[model samples]
Target: MTAKPMTAAGASRASVLFPAVAAFAIGFGLIFMSGLVQAETLHDAAHDVRHATGFPCH
Candidate 1:
């Protein structure tokens, strides 16, 4: 048996992933580029996030 060629309908489904990947890249870039942030501020933010996510950081 021969494989079927790809059509726009199948290709369109793959396009849905681009926005989610872009959003993750943008958010991570913002966090990484904010270098002037104080250590205490970063620690507090991380601590808060850990608690919010129920992840043990200690």
Candidate 2:
């Protein structure tokens, strides 16, 4: 089967715009969801890391 050539508008819109839009949407969703997650501070990570390292951060 042969592929038909795309119209000028279709080609530009598909190649340039669709991927740019999809990437922007993915980045926006990631940033938006990150705001919903609880972030740990250095002090919070210290204990976990210490225990994992067999150091016992207490």
Candidate 3:
């Protein structure tokens, strides 16, 4: 069987929107939660993310 070609019509709004919304929610949640905690706690949590994203933090 032959493979079908991809088209713009095959892309749904939810496919793109879901990731954006999820990321926004995660960021908002992190920010909100951090405010409720201490600096050391936030730093530890963000440290993992920074390394994962290849961001340098000292």
Candidate 4:
């Protein structure tokens, strides 16, 4: 049996809020509870290098 997909036609305004709240909860948990990203990723390192006072890499 196939599971039915959800859609906006059946969703209320508060349903949209659920995803935003879930995202915030995940971000908050990762930053505060897990400490998972304190070590810089490549993107973070590159971003820092880009912002280092001399040039706008735009």
Candidate 5:
């Protein structure tokens, strides 16, 4: 059986798709890891940033 070469459109789609998939995977992994942390710990870490952004934590 002969193998088909990738067309320009397919190559372009793959290039865009790979980075998007990689980014989604990385983001999901980070959220999953953060979920394992205690709520208070996460709150403490983001406390300063929240206040800086004028977000009320109280």
Candidate 6:
């Protein structure tokens, strides 16, 4: 059996689709993990990020 070559349209659709699907999966995973993290832990991380970026988070 021989594998069929991908058409131009099929390749274009796949290129667009893969990123969208990956982004959605990453976003969903982050949201799910955020829910499981403690509030203080989250706040501390945010605060550290803010300070690291030179944004005063007083």
Give the number of the best model, judged by lDDT.
5
Give Cα distance to truth, residue 43, candidate 6, Å.
12
The local distance difference test score of each candidate is 0.62, 0.59, 0.66, 0.56, 0.68, 0.66
lDDT of 4 by residue, 20-57 (tens): 89999988975442233343463354555545643343
Task: State the displacement of the C-alpha of residue 18, model 2, in Å, after optimal TM-score superposition.
Answer: 0.3
Q: Rank by TM-score, highest first.
A: 5, 6, 2, 3, 1, 4
Model 4, total clashes: 0
On TM-score, the candidate that comes out on top is: 5
TM-score of each: 0.34, 0.38, 0.37, 0.33, 0.40, 0.39
Candidate 1's displacement at residue 52, Å, is 15
lDDT of 2 at 30: 68
lDDT of 2 by residue, 1-58 (tens): 8977778666755587888999999998764443333345533645455556554344
Error of 1 at 50 (Å): 15
lDDT of 3 at 56: 55
Worst 10 residues of 1 by lDDT: 30-39
Candidate 1: tens digits of C-alpha lDDT, residues 1-58? 8966768665555676897799999988766534324466665667766556555444
Higher-lDDT candidate of 5 and 6: 5
- How are the candidates ranked when ordered by lDDT, highest leading? 5, 3, 6, 1, 2, 4
Shift in Å, residue 43, candidate 2: 17
Model 5 TM-score?
0.40
RMSD of each: 6.9, 9.8, 7.8, 9.4, 5.6, 6.4
How many clashing pairs does model 6 include? 0
Q: For each candidate, how many residue pairs have backbone atoms clashing (under 3 Å)?
A: 0, 0, 0, 0, 0, 0
- Better TM-score candidate (3, 6): 6
User: How good is model 1 by TM-score?
Assistant: 0.34
